[model samples]
Target: MEISKGQSPHTQPNMRTAKVYTALESLLCVNCKQQQIIQNCESFLKLDAQLRNKRARELKVCLNCLRGGHFLSNCNSRSTYKKCHRKHHTLIHLEVNKANETIPIPQQIVNENTITNTSNQTNSTTNLSSSTLNAQTLLSTAMVKVNDTEHNSHQIRVLLDSAFQSNFVSEGLFVPQISSALPTHTFNRNAIEIPPNIKLADPRFNESRPIDVLLGAGIFWSLLSVGQVKVNQLILQRSKLGWLISGELVNQRFISDQTRASFFSLNELDHKLERFWQVDEFTSNDHILTNDEEYCEEYFRKTTTRDEAGKFIVKIPFKASVHNKLGNSYDVALARLKNLERRFETNPVLQENYIKFMQEYQRLNHMSNIENNNDNAFYLPHHAIIRESSETTKLRVVFDGSCKLETGLSINEAQFTGPTLQNDIFSIIARFRLHQYVFTADVEKMYRMVWVHPEHRRYQRILWRETTNDEICTYELNTVTYGTTSAPYLAIRCLIQIALDNQDYYPLESQVIKEDVEYSQEYSSLPSLDMSQ
Candidate 1:
């Protein structure tokens, strides 16, 4: 005990017994507010105080331990015992009574069902292993009616689970009421034959009803299982319900279907092949030929286009011809001119068509004459060829850059062939079959669609005139011309650029058409290129 705040350090002893008691009482008086007495060591005074405090505060106590600080729900006790009608945490008879009266036992006895190997009673007291408890906890019950006899049909609870490989019913259901509905095949466990769809009687569930059957995967793929469902006034879509269905059940729901018109048939493929063999009649307005020489001349004056020097030019890389020729041999150019003139004189149809073709070329400004004194200009050998086309009279002009010179160097030899500029043909064909709707169109005058660099244009000089009476004039082809090895590379490269530049304007269409483009070289090795590329 503490003495006094200002007293001596030692406490004085009392000689008399009564005096000792009085002194002890006096010592207790010191710091009375902070003092307490414990009558018995086992009293657990601190615990008593806590209980008292909880009672005073009117706090809840755990039903299991009848102690304060937590509710029955949060209690950590795993012990279970039988009481009124089911398992409980406390013994009713042993609990404290409010009136201190004699406890009277109820007439009804509560039953607890324990899984066992022998007894078939629905509810009976029996020892249960932890595994049994766990299994019971994991099971979910649903009420269902077994199709037995018309007069004996009864509703029972069924376990809906996927653990069992097949569906099963209680063997007790083998009674006359459901015997006729049962199938011959049965499920056996430990030499016992259990009937399908009718098993021995089992306890029913209490939540909604009693459990009677175990529904397994055998019937999961059947109509008994629902593919679509809705609840709580909200519609459930297939995507949401698919999780509940077995993979096999879901897969069985769909079969292969190829009835759509979009499916290309063998006949359609044959037709496509036939079309490939036919002449390509498709023609562009810019390259259309006419029979009037005057009309052709006027068109040339109106539509000729040119590119600014060095601003936007395609680079061409070609190995110099062994001949080392810089310009068209004048003799060769003159010979080609005379050959065309003689053909037109003999074939009137050729003369008229030739005039129209020249006029159109002039209008497009595809060709222009170099200054008479421009000695630096390289002359390109030109020739006219006639071929059978599905459309108008056929005449195509080609530049013969391959002509050999005395030194073994030709125009084509000096130019660059550029890189492999086309896409793989196989890739184009693959994506072509991907879409339901397909569209195809050819670029008119595909090679001439691009302009040559001004510096390079001077090397593409050609000899042309309106008629035999007209003076022979020198002109440079301003665009990529046919018969030039670099034409395909230049045209394809330009096409790729155009598609990339306009992708933002037509994203979907651009992606689809881009797959159709066929380029040359390296393409055959790229087997992974798809529509996106």
Candidate 2:
């Protein structure tokens, strides 16, 4: 008791910590007011967390040894809370006073149903209160680690629901893909200072980005730990996902009147959800092609031609007339490359596969080093996606044609997202089962086989470096870049044209290529071995 009550911080670390916390839990930042390094405050917070953890051990005093001679944090005794799973026991003492005094017991026990009703009322109250916002209250947003199909944890931004309500997610959000882009979009960090050694769930937490997931009741509670720190209105809570920050910001400019109106309600979110599902990626012959698509088709037919090698050469269908307005994208692409390097550090095999893919791309004359810079060039940001189930390739390079820089310009944005011209996947599968002998074949580097016109090759420039020590070099992709929106259309349309040109000579084969092949993948069935051959 005397040791804990010591006046000097050197005697009792808790005394100093108590003072630091009291000063921190204010409406404004004390460190900022004193013109000190904000990081110093964060450093102190780390120290505090470490100290608390150490103290937690001491706090778990042996209950059975209370009447014993010496004090110990833990013991061999098996006494515990059972539910907590920790080596500590909680003793609740109830006092029975005079005969007239009754035991302090609740009138009713709150079951799951009663608590659920209370939650409904709480949500209703919250909704009612949300109409009038005198001041802004920032909700807890975190970066949670979600496992992909390959068991790799991808950091996804999620809302930490303190209210412990139901989770809201669009269907098929969790369908693990081989790879996906990060920071979907970057946001501005307005005077926000994060401490060193503290890994945030989302590195760009202060920035305004779309919330990818919303964690509810059970998950929200499970994510919490005993570690927490407060900087003025901003409070950081450590959790399983990482450190989560909530409360208002110090900068008023961060939240303006214009942006305040941008917050979405449940109704608005539902409308977005409907629109999200309505945007079909597949376009079949069942629906008439749009005007832009038809124009793209005509452009392909008029400009597209086969060389002596019978290789189809097509130009990128650029819908935007303002090709001159795009800004320099080399730096943006380089940044993404560096990011990819950091990701590859953990998996050397993925890096090797990526390097081989790029090397093969260059060796096949699909891409060439740029000797002269093009006035209208776009450098694509590339990353690797691991598909363990893939028979041909486990790791494939995915170029982000839709990757935009500060200028909000990208290859996909400039070019038309040409219509999906192939038959439905269902139709292809149905036709495969109809034949006695079914065979499948993938067109090896099929997209690479189709060359991009020299005029449009300038728009498909990419940056790459085989090794980290090597200098990054810019190269033009001579082939139809797989990532571009119209590449699929160009590849599939070329096959259709080939079938048309050879229809009279090889009628049956031409017919099979035209009808049965779906974007270089021949998933067809033949009745007999002779026909299959």
Candidate 3:
């Protein structure tokens, strides 16, 4: 209508409700008095709700004009705005220049029953002269006919929904489901089988028929090759659900299908995933904690019990392999002793780190000498290697338990290879991403934090030199030694044990660590290791 109200004077009014003004043509007739006809009609306006409520009993207010004692037609506000068309408001003439516009059904095709029933019940009817419906046609149904080469042509009622990417037919249409995972992502997972067909569908005018299949973007991509093909007078045009084929083709390429994603298959290699990769730079922080006497004493107290003689006996088990390499390992240890002496002479910093390392080793009681050259214990051979990294200036010493004898049997060969104890890299990255802020710290000398049983310490001996010219000395390692096959197992198991032991102090972090460590073991085929302290 020619609505002149406030800032938006030229805006159209809704015609269905009596609360708003009707169009100029609906209000005026050439032979009739327009004022007298509209004065009796009700009016609607965007009035101050409080003002209307205060004057509700006394004032005969015009809701369209927001004035007292008269209706919209009798008010002066309706006469100020101009009309572009004689039959309708100026706002109705604005056109949308889009590729897909809703096309209305012909008069003959629209069910007579719908019009008669609507008019009789609600006094509502469609504009017969108008050739289009609202763009959002909720009842978007279609009749799809399968033109198959191998099977007989069949028809199915389909709903063209663009929300999903894949086409879906009833599970009854396909054979038994395969053992492999289905390609479709919907909750109703079913097999994807191809029917050799050139599908054609007539957008159904009625919403009565139930949809048997859903034609998604997957089906739309196949129709791109057909290009503007027609069925009778219907030509393809884009719609929200997909293309609508009802009018003549305006151009050879009606609309581009760039919105749909192109699908592809993964190669055989891509399907085989071995381990997760991490890109974060991890640095060792082992250099700062040179004094480990306190750490060693705590582990000793937690892991040992006093015997009748008041001696600390380690309660942990020491499992060794059947193969023995004591002889060859001794030879390697002697050679490494010479190399260590030479390095001590050349590098003063190494001498300091070595002195501190030995101090902590002695305080921890990591090894003890055989009494009076006793032959009862196994004299395990050990060799030392220097580790230098960007994280630390001083080189750290690591013992080698893999050195073999003439029989080719070493400590690593004789010990249990232990279960996989580390968490997968992907899970760590995922958890890191979950929190807003993150910090990571490495455990210093993690392997040396755990102790070995006094009996098992006999198999973890090492050779050392107090001075460059001093006689070589032998000491059995009373702690888990690095470079051994079972070392990782023993260390990781101990770490988990310590976490469990202190879980009550930091419940949340401990629970997370425990769950992460146990998750793989529960799902994997590998035998679960006993990690109780």
Candidate topping TM-score: 2
> What are the per-residue Cα lDDT tens digits for candidate 2 across 1-533?
12223456465544632332343333332323333432233432343333423333444423432212234454656665554455432221122333333232222231211212243322211211112223345567776666644344456668777575777653336523311222222335545566777777666665556667777886889878888888777788898877877776544333322111222235556677765754544334466889998899889988998899889989888876745566887777777777777767887888889989898888889889986474667778777787999888887887788776667777687788777766777677778899889988788877888899998887788888877899888899899887888888888888788888989999988877876787878988989999866
Report the poorest 10 consecutive residues by lDDT, candidate 2.
123-132
lDDT of 1 by residue, 1-533 (tens): 33323333364454222222244442221112223322121222223333433432353445454444576678777665554332233322332233343332321232432333334422223342211011111133444554432122356655555557856566545322211211111212222222343322222221223335666767433423333443322222222112121111112212222121112224556677666743243322133334332332343234333355421255444343422345446656666666667666777776787778777887888777655433555566555567886364388766777866555567666655544433345455555565554545556777766777676676677777768999888887878877776677567656655666679997755554454555421111122336324
Please state the error at residue 284 of candidate 3 in Å.
26
Evaluate candidate 1 by giving its C-alpha RMSD to the native, one decimal: 32.7
User: Who is ahead in TM-score, 1 or 2?
Assistant: 2
Q: What tens digits encode model 3's per-residue C-alpha lDDT throughout 331-406?
A: 5556656655665676776677777777677887665654323343344433234555536524445666665556
lDDT order of candidates, best first? 2, 1, 3
Q: Which residue runs of candidate 2 sit more than 4 Å off their true CA positions?
A: 1-160, 165-287, 322-326, 372-374, 389-391
- Kindly give the stretch of ten consecutive residues in candidate 3 with the minimal lDDT sum: 183-192
Please list the Cα RMSD from the true structure of every candidate, rounded to 1 decimal place.
32.7, 26.1, 27.7
Candidate 1 weakest lDDT stretch, 10 residues: 129-138
Error of 1 at 312 (Å): 5.5
Model 1 alpha-carbon miss at residue 427, Å: 2.2
lDDT of 2 at 82: 57
TM-score of 3: 0.36
